[model samples]
Target: MTLDRRTFLGTAAVATLAAPMVRAQGKPKVVVIGGGAGGATAARYIAKDSDGAIDVTLVEPTRKYYTCFFSNLYIGGFRDLASIGHTYGTLASDYGINVVHDWAVGVDRDAMTVTLTGGDTLPYDKLILSPGIDFVDGAVPGWDITAQNAMPHAYKAGSQSELLKAQVEAMPEGGLYAMVAPPNPYRCPPGPYERISMVAHVLKQTNPSAKILIVDPKQSFSKQALFEEGWQKHYGGMVERIGPDFGGANVSVNPDEMTVDIDGAVEKVDVCNVIPAMKAGRIAELAGVTDGNWAPVNASDMSTKADPDVYVLGDASAQGDMPKSGFSANSQAKVCANAVRGALTGSRVFPAKYANTCWSLIDENDGVKVGATYEATPDKIAKVDGFISQTGEDADLRKATYEESVGWYAGITADMFG
Candidate 1:
């Protein structure tokens, strides 16, 4: 169901609405860093639910947001580039939010202020950071952001996705395409496999003889059986995956030579996609909330372990059991929003529960999904129940799953932006 912001804010039976509004200071300012699923959802929900009782500001450098979730479909020729782009107009005008297009450079916990690139300081009663993932420096030998034009990671989902698709389309007949997959605990666990499926779909229709190779660090991956089955059925003999046991762990690349070295064996490729090990975005580190690569958070409300007034969400948060997916971020945002509002406006705080589902398309009308419900524990967000799509599903069921994903995309974007 679509979250009608007006109705939810007006008549959600919030216990605090009956009493006089009480804020920590003034309207209880909430400053959110980043504008992806988690940040956007958090900002919108806090502003809309408070009904002018809270002042919310969202910090995002980009004027338009392109979702990483369905970007692979665009690469596969299932969607166009403009279809995935969204604007913050609605969040600003309709939700009564201050949407600032500026980079957040620093966070001073002592003063409870965020410094922007434009030299403006924003104060916050509660701060939410959802800055997404950034690749570890030098994680992939011979590959870095400077070589992105030649070898695109396209994980952040914007111009990089367009560049990757262009490179794929421009590949010569029978050209080789290679991918260096990331290790565990990365954003979108099934993303790389889904990307492979999309790439295979494109090559099958465009360059039938083109070869695809995957150099993976992990021996096993999310939905491994389902993906392997689909590859065998749809693109037999066209794709080859080398796992760590087969020297996938010992690999390097040269963008200039278009070569991949796998255990001292070199293979030349026309295009390369290198997904390196990731960490929380720079702002999270600047906030001093990160423990090495990611910021640990209290699962019940996404509050940072280092600071109670601050929250971390989405890929940057080391919340347990949730596989850094957009659905997980959106769910976590709701729980966070509730907690923040309760703290600011004395609302009824409900028990924290979260849920997430990830869907991957293997082919046209062929989709698989994994989903779970979770609860907050002393240690982490522990899984309560879960299910996954099996390999050998009927065509109708797969089609239904795919259709369900389409609906979810619509529902979630609306929930986040509106």
Candidate 2:
């Protein structure tokens, strides 16, 4: 159940072995579930800062991850998949962290162990759960895994991204592409809008006559004015947005007929991207770490209210005022890592300052960003000062911002897994 650094590294060839092993000396066993933005960064930071004081094991099924941050560029044909995809080999070889390719099935709080899908249980002194978000099934009728094959939601930023791109490429010049945006408190508030913009950018190039319809459950969205301005100036008459007043045009899709019903009206589209309601990843729910859909955590440490030794971060945790984005996840990871280290080492935990910046691309050459920093209060997350891109900014500035966003992606990916 317990794996030491040497045994774990040595058993790389026979990872399936379940032999009993002696525990390492002067090290706290830390098992991190999920290897996306939050889990990867937390594992690397803990391994680096702990300095042989803690054993870090990262449990994730995927060896490589395609980030959602700049995936819009991929949709717009501005970037290749290789540019966004990252591997965990660097985290293993360079950071001295045990990277386990396994899905966490359950958590036994009484035994302080995590059960894997392979029927193996790994004991840990502390656990970090950053399993991210999972789409809510039945949130939209007639839309499930099978339905997603035709109408892809590239929210996970991998195969789904490729599928959505393929649909866009195959669409006729005058075809319609429909995207249904989820309600607030979901992963990546501006993400759905950014996706629409990117799709429009592609349409401008390949299918100039193509039209985009955005169906949203909410009245307003993050960076609404900026997105609207960019859409009007660049893709006018091609893009249309319908809010709740327009009949709650956000819910339900019929993937078979490629039709989506908004309120009472039915609209046919060439392609549909349904971003359904979301919840913390399945493992969090299995472990009883979530209330309804989100894991309740202390903002200062991101430790779950239900469990003291387990911390949840990223989209899985209820981080008030922090939109579920890669920037926020990475920021939360660092804070949680420090808190876990302090708790294990009997050191004082300092007040945490969290920051996030989300960049949305209107075109390959144009981008807008919204950023903010916050301190956790008793009731809610209060934002500090930050600014969106200035309205009607010069074209050159927008181009510069797009380039800056690419750099940010590279830097953050390196910070997370490198």
Listed per candidate, the RMSD to the true structure in angstroms reads 2.6, 7.5
Worst 10 residues of 1 by lDDT: 7-16
How many residue pairs clash in all the candidates, one count each?
Answer: 0, 0
CA RMSD (A), model 1: 2.6
Best by TM-score: 1
Which digits, one per residue and each the tens of the lDDT, describe model 2 over residues 169-202? 9998799999888877788888998888989988
On residues 39-135, what C-alpha lDDT tens digit does candidate 1 reach at each position? 9999998888788888999999999999999999999988888988999999999999999999999999999999999999999999999999999
Residue 238, candidate 2: Cα error in Å is 0.1
Candidate 2 has its poorest 10 consecutive residues by lDDT at 12-21
* Predictions in order: lDDT: 0.92, 0.84
